[model samples]
Target: METTATIRGEIVTFLQNRSMTINQFARISGINSGTLSNILNGHRPMSMHQLDRITDGMGLEEGYFYDLYIPECIFHTTPDWRRLGPFLLRCAELGKLGCLHRAARMTLENISYAPMLFDMAEALFNEDKHEAAALLYESVAECEKFQYSERLALCQYRLFVIGLGENQDENLQAAVYFEPYIDRLDDMYQLDAYVKLINVNISLQRWDKIVALGKRMGHKAKIHYQQNRYRFRTYEYPRKSVIFYILYSYLIQASMHQEQGDYDNAFYYVSLYEHPDWINKPNEEELLIIEQFKDWAEANRYMYGLMSGQPNALNQYVDYVDSREDEIFLALCNIMIAANRYQLHIDHILDRYKEHLVFKTQQNQLGKISDLVTLNRYTRLLAELGIYYLNSKQFDRGLAYILDSLEYSIRTKSDNGMLRCMGIFEQFRHFSSEETQRRYTELIQDVQKLSVYAWSPQV
Candidate 1:
């Protein structure tokens, strides 16, 4: 039997076996008759104190009713967080995430408990219960609405970071969440917020916005550094160097152009980061990251040359990327290299990584937000496999894979993936039958509509 049902049944049986009328039991338990009657009839739920009174009145142990009632009330009751906070902390410590989530949901409207709730949420987040922590943080944010407090900004920042591994919708929501607080943020948080916003713009293919924001961030960081130079010299440089944000902004702009397949523009943005004076200012770790990004941009530039049929470019780039361990960029290099090798090589590579790719794709799809890079990777893989099949004259299989790729790309708002699939469809149009060509034409039209709608003012 269910725990609640068993408890309810046991309570009724205890009253019956004791030969107690409702009024007598109510008086003994110090509960009103109607409340007792309602509880017995299952028309209302019992509170913690009411259950305790019943247990005590029946000469049972002090905590017998508490054990039965708490689990039920944790989810259903309007929380008195003063009473519930300790219980929730215990639940989190004990790894009872289900109970923790229940308590968080119940406590959403407890505005007075926002500080304690934020603390608990932070604890949960630190414990890697991201979804539960996000729920609690959201509750705190809602309860503390219209306040320009640090706590509220922290909540939005947490949501933004968590949303990065989710989907486009989550990224968009995170962007919106941080919008109002951008100007009020401290220097560090302001830079972080702009970086996250740039990421969202990249996923949405908002190239103009990415460039504009990048410039704005750069200008702001420059002014901030100029204003704070005296303080930095006096205090021995406690915070992050202002040059870090400026370099990061340049890297984001470079990535924006790279995503749009504009290698010249991408290289120009990378050149901004490579300026000698700016390059010399970064600390060790920051310099290492910057070097990694520079290498990535150079590798992508090589890939573009190979894709454009430049002689020996594939072999040269493959040799350069062969010794690298960065998984995502390495995967991109390997995929392109395999395409250059042979159809069988491409098939073998796809087969090897197929399960991992599908699992990641499904996980992202099931999440509240999708991972932008993973979605792009999965979609590209499908398109590549489709192209290979088409080249091998497997018309039906190729069409199925390409169409599926387009659907997935559109669903996730992956502009890169959609564009890739469209290119494949156009390149292979002559190989498909007339009816299939018509279908491909319709799909292209739909993709166009989706692109328009995505950027539309009404949307």
Candidate 2:
């Protein structure tokens, strides 16, 4: 019953070199002397906790024995979840991805372990250890690739969310990849998935895609709401209330229509979400959602009227949004777009909210949903302001705004935003000073470099 020679020999050598007794080492490592004796004699398996303490007592670097522990303690025999689970969790916490991958791959050799890995991945995901979680999720997903299971769909969904970031092109790819699996997900998740997909599409300014997704989301939400309204309603629900999705679907559709310049249709969809009287026995949560949407509808009505060239709409929209500080940023963005479109001057309005024009994320009831959408609108606002100033023949101010827009586009990796900025700068290049022109060239070069890097093949 000799211990695995490699790890045991290392420990023996360390003790010999330091003239340390087993009892001394045990005292230092906080392990019971008998347990250490058993571990050294191969009478007991070395748990991850014991291994960590042993490594520390030897004055070695953290996780120094992890690679050795895998074969000596884990893969040398059948992998036990009691040992493997805590081991993987420790790996995630310590950012020991190499060891995590090695252990995970060994355990996943049997597809029966997929569920265990998947559950651990979910735990890691909730703990915000995304990279480690992604490894498990990918491993589990690959194991279940040919199967049409809800777990597989959930893995894909997790991967989709993990993959999303500042890169617009990458976000679109993730959305497209996760789209088909949406139907395979349980009812609770599909609405949130649709909402996330729609947000990505909104950043890309894919109005048609948003419209299509919104319709599907609305339909699914309506069906679920009706089917479950009279039931006990004890089951787990989506992040938002059920009716929130339906109302959100309508709100998004109206916004998409507004973006497309179909003001009449936009107003029609706005009205659909405005009242929401069809909600059966509305709870406090549902009532809050309805109220929020109503406020949005009211503001949007002013936005639509202003965008469609109604003379009186500008003052009213400004007054409404001014009273609601949370709405100021997005409301001003819409106002600028309208002013640019209709050749209306908003100098007074801009001066009034000049302090609010900076890019800080505004919090809303629905987490993360408004952050990205607000960012997209803010970027567009920058470009619109540039255009407005240029049209007014304010060369320095106009180029300043344009440069800011280009910088933000580059930061966000928004290809569409970058292109728009490039086009706008090119249109006004003749009016730009030498300093502004040089800055523009530098930004364009950065864009080109990013483009090349994005298209480069991974080794």
Candidate 3:
């Protein structure tokens, strides 16, 4: 679209009318002398920042620029406000975002009615919109003032994205501008801001700075980032520069990719967000990434697990099931046994992942007996029951769990699983009386002497 060169140059003209010299004006207006000279001489860009500073340092209503030009050729002209909007909308539906953007930029540069100009810009935005959404977004800002600051700033922030291209730099500026209204902004928008800030700083290669900024931003930045750590393993960035894009680009990319079910890139970009730069920044949309990853992983694992069971890859799938199912089972056992829900947890273990339970039918668990699956579901249940007894202040019962878990863990050579048993062993000693602890400890060394396993059925 068109740059605001005329409006910017106008600011230089406004400054020139003042009696202050270049040095004096620079000092008073707090604008850079170099920039001011360029603006006055028509050699530089005029920015909204310049307009704002000029408005503040000088007594100009900012609307004065609008009034100076009688017809107000700032955004759109032709008084075709009504038709162009709908016409532009039609063009956009037919795939003409660029045309819409040009028309909108022209409107902003030509029209006196600021809202009309915004409409024209929005029109351009709506046309063949995806490529130029950011441009349209930036066009939302109007030179005219809105009475409510929050509404005005939000409008401006959106327009800033459109006009400037949604790159990190532009979004960062937008974020800072809307910062005062930050507390009142929605959580998703806040996350967008923090993500933009982090991304901009990273592109600038200011990681060291992000370390502190991340902490300062708090949960708005971190919750999703941290939770997705495990989920991102499947994602691959493939390159570096792909990490940073303007706000418009990021949104467009995210929206378009979502339709394709292509999550790797989205997750990768979010991983960049999870870095020291964005971690802990609290924002509402924060959960979107993690939730998305969880959904993806859950679906992927199930699909892969099913495929893994094919005769073509049964052994491989068995290995796959071995690696994951055991860990999940152990964690479940730990959580449920500690909570005294062993029976309920047992049903969960059996109903789900039953195919992965490779043991035979004779070992006793869940009201049945199983004989062959040596280190299978039955053994785990036994271990968990021991843990439940232990967790419930029953040292003898806890010792029984450790011993059962030990038997299974030993047969399986699951060192990790053994570590869990050792943990309970320590818990028993910590909670039990010294005399009882010593006896259980001795029993642990000689499991054959235990009375519970010495059961002789009287039929």
TM-score of each: 0.60, 0.95, 0.27
Whose lDDT is greatest here? 2
> Residue 18 of candidate 1: its Cα lDDT?
88
Taking all chains together, the TM-score of candidate 2 against the true structure is 0.95
Per-residue lDDT over 199-273 for candidate 1, one digit per residue giving the tens place of the 0 to 100 score: 677667677878888888888987876776445233322234566577767777776765666778877877777
Clashing pairs for predicted structure model 2, backbone only: none
The CA-based lDDT of model 2 is what?
A: 0.87
How much is 224 displaced in model 3, in angstroms? 14
RMSD of each: 9.2, 2.6, 24.8
Q: How do the residues 319-401 of candidate 2 rate in per-residue lDDT, one tens digit apiece?
A: 89877878888888888888888899889999999988898878654444446677787888899999999999997898889
State in Å the error of residue 262, model 1: 5.9
Candidate number of the best TM-score: 2
What C-alpha lDDT do the candidate models reach, one value each?
0.66, 0.87, 0.45
Error of 3 at 315 (Å): 22
RMSD score of candidate 1 (Å): 9.2
How many residue pairs collide in each prediction? 4, 0, 51
Q: Which stretches of candidate 3 lie over 4 Å from their true place?
A: 1-80, 90-139, 142-148, 155-188, 219-459
Clashing pairs in 1: 166-369, 166-370, 167-369, 167-370
